[model samples]
Target chain A: MSGATSRATTARDAHRTAHVVGRVLGVGVSLGVLVIVVGLVLMLLRHPGYTTGQVPLHALIGRHARFPVGIEGLVRALRHGSAAGVVLLGVVVILASPIVGAIVAAGGFLAARDLRIGVIALVVVLILLVATVAL
Target chain B: MPITPLLFILVLVLVAAVAGLLGSLVGLGGGVIVVPVLTLVFHVDIRLAVGASLVTVIATSATGASRLLRRDLVHLRLALFLAVATTLGAITGALVSRHVPTRVLFVLFAAVLGYSAVAMLRRRPEAAPRAGHSDAVANALGLNASAPVGEGGQVVHFEVRRSILGLVAMYGAGVVSALLGIGSGALNVPTMDVLMGVPLKVASATSSFMIGLTAAASAAIYLSRGQIDPLIAAPIAIGVLGGATLGARLLTSVNAVVVQRLFIVVLAVVAIEMLQKGFA
Candidate 1:
């Protein structure tokens, strides 16, 4: 292939990968949102305070009363089928979406033989992981 | 402040959705609107509101950029390159926010925003080179890319120009975001689209992509601090995600000129509001 044709081919391949990555991101975020919605519905049903005009500032305190802390706590909550737990799980999933996208992009770049961007993607993943862990 | 529990939750979600829609349209994280609604209208604690707003911002970026990516409008390479400068700026801004006269900075930011609005409204050619080095630099970096134009199968290929300027603008955007607690999309879109010569659609998409990564940094801090309540963050995030998806789809159908006009309007409104608050 001529140089221009080769470049075009790479761009085309990159575009397809971009679409797939986009769909992956969308599905991950949508699932997170869906889980949260389910958790909210369950909370409404289980908590009498919601219907009773109580649980004032409910988001600020009432939910915090039984809040899950850290990644491990979120996993434990999801296992128990607790509403707040499920909601926390949603939050965790949503937070992880970009990190997952970055990692996938890194892999995709490597597969494409695009070393510079692949290295950059790996650096991005590292930054994200460090940020997540440091906090 | 004394509203019923269910009613408050419903209102919160609704308002967050509105914010997300408007934010995505203007390339913001929607926190600009969500923060005030939570703090002033709902009378939530400022810290709590900020935490919830940050999470909502992340949700807005994730959904908005995802759709843009699928549409092939996001310049992923450009976004990743700029992220380095933006992150550095964020750290610097956070360190200086407490010591600086933010009211003065607000005036300066509003001025920059006004200038961007003018640049956007002038209807200038978007692909023009900014300097002699622009084309050479872009070529060397392989920053040339393409996007699907309208309903046509044909594409418009363009190269990134004046990225030093874009990087500087991104750094400013990041600083403003960290300092003022507003999403930097207002600045990012114009910087990329107008200064760096990225197409408006691509610029907005890339801005959304950048916002996701930048917000994730502080968002982690806020969550780890136990500042975010699951109930508040969860519902606001759901609404933001939904609204941003709608906005992203709308973006594909809308003309580039119309999106630019709307972006200008958003910046003007945000600028005026910031100025008013600063003076008050």
Candidate 2:
């Protein structure tokens, strides 16, 4: 009877481990997808073919278009633009990310009623946003 | 040609990693590390170096802030209120940077470094502790006027007036960040921790949280100048993030005294370099 119970406990623990591993992988995959999608979208938005005039990417959208964009063209345009709009747009993105990160974290906390974790996630999101911009 | 083959990527990553490690350990940013290296070692233009360095300061702040936020170490209420002032100050600073000569900016940078060294040397006298959320005081200092935030954990209260001083200090920090591309950690941490009576941990976290936004505000100006090099900023960001994670892990449960001493020495050297830049 004891031996049988131990086996059952081991099986339950294994199942829990597998579940956690899946969750971690899921989060990682989701973040990766988000980064890629954002990169692709920005690239399309700043495509050489997409120019409205001599404005280019930085002039049209903001300095965010110059944020390395995982491609060379966006960076080039950002480094070459001569408008105040670039700075204005960058300020907007810079200000917005933390709010977005906080709201998401707040929602998660509300769902779980775990304010501690929520605060932590909020901070994390802010940091990640800054890290992305600095990059 | 061929987008420069990202040759600077690995070098910048390594540089940023080192900066993050030292910055965390010594409470400074990779800017102190990146600026000289970019101009001296990598042969980047000085203007571009400054521009890229400013962007990385924002990155380091964002990375460290996130980790601290997770632990709920940041005084969100205080940070938000002060952020309003700091943001305004930062915008003003960026605008001012256009008017200041690079040589004068270097002199100003050196003065800030000297101030930080003096601050580090003086020990704070233990004083009567104060409340973090005094409604009257908070309102007077503009804390109550800030966007309210909710964070779970023990509601640690501190005095409000000092926090306002910290915000003012950050304004100076913002100017330095905009002018020099060096993150104002040297200034921000001391201001928040020592003057404001915030705990070292919270001060560090809050400073990290503030730096990025401040830097981002200034970086907008640089971006308009067409100076930010994606090749430099991208690698530095990724590298610093990874390196800071490792550094933070290593930092847990270590004696910080030695680190502080080393930081003073390094700052002094950097200060001398700034003086030279000014004179040059």
Candidate 3:
């Protein structure tokens, strides 16, 4: 990668790898989506009724699924490969992406000696954690 | 007539795909379309629909970010700074959502949608200010960015004007995202374009980057409340992810102005219907 391939040394070059943020975000969500795909396929096979059966809109989605929360929830879900567990695991993965992304960005900024943005990134991470854990 | 689970998933997939496509074309998250369709057409509770839409929003964002983040289109400093405010707003929004009267919420959301429709119809603005020389705040935070335009990259010299207002608007955007389950691009893009003076593509890209993070912050609240239906969210996520990937690829080739106008028309109709529903 020639320096001249890009012009300004803006936020893009703040990290050693411009694409690290992409890979981090992409991998996290894609992995989650993949689990959902498998879980859906399994769901259809296990209960063929889902293919053609219908329920009232409220009855179908009004009640949230019985999924675990926080670290214990994640651990319990991962330990079991049941269809429900797999689906919950997918949800867990999606929920963790931003927290993970902030960590990556903060680390990158710190590595590049840009403390201002690094601290800002750290604050976002902390805020997300508080929201996730408290709310 | 009642809908079956199989039929429901198929319908959701179809709607989410269309939403994703249009959203990517216009640089918004597909949730703006998804939430209304799910609530009005499917007769789902607004909260449940919002929960489902949030998942699709994250999926749509993540798929696009995999490409855009590397293209140098995303302004990370801007996105993260905004996220600080937005995430706090999201948490509060989720907490207060059930308390907000549904009718009032509808009226408020409709107003936001109406405003966005008008903004979308306006002509595109000029490129961002000359690059290289950054203001004190901008340089200190590494907000100055560049995008690859024409042959070489163009340094987008942008000074974030109205810093407090921008943060406040982002907070409102986050609140709306959590409350209505829309991506809230209706506010973010405009705030960046009109207030901050970032280039259009850069603003859109940054907004797109922030969507996942914003949704993630809010999704946890919904999850803890037992509002997210995995069965409903999973298929929609799959479809939106697919559609957004296609839409992102078509972005450069398509005439964005035409698409923007068409989307505004559709949004206007939805807003009207939602207002009536609120009154009813």
**Global fold similarity of model 1 (TM-score):** 0.80
* Candidate 1 DockQ vs. native: 0.39
Task: Please give, for residues B72-96, the per-residue lDDT of candidate 3 as tens digits.
Answer: 6777778888899888888888889
Lowest lDDT 10-residue stretch of candidate 1 chain A:
A1-10
Backbone clash tally (model 3): 6
Clashing pairs in 3: A53-B4, A53-B5, A54-B3, A54-B4, A54-B5, A55-B3
lDDT string for model 3 (A4-80, tens) is 21223433355344478888888988899888888777767776665656433445465543554445565676687
Q: lDDT: which candidate is best?
A: 3
Candidates' TM-scores?
0.80, 0.63, 0.88
- Tell me the lDDT of candidate 2: 0.54
Is 2 or 3 the stronger prediction by DockQ? 3
TM-score of chain A of 1: 0.81
Order of candidate numbers by DockQ, starting with the best: 3, 1, 2
Q: What are the candidates' C-alpha RMSDs?
A: 4.5, 12.2, 3.6
List chain B TM-scores, each candidate: 0.75, 0.79, 0.90
Model 1 per-residue lDDT tens digits across residues B1-280: 4766667678878877777776666555667666556644665544556557666766667776787787777877777778767765655554455466746655655665676577557645434323333455456446776666424535666667787877788887877665545567777887887678776767777888777777665555556656567877887887776777677678777676676677678778867865664576
lDDT (10s digit) by residue, model 2, range A63-114 = 3434433223344435665222232234234333444434443454434444
Clashing pairs in 1: none
DockQ of each: 0.39, 0.04, 0.44
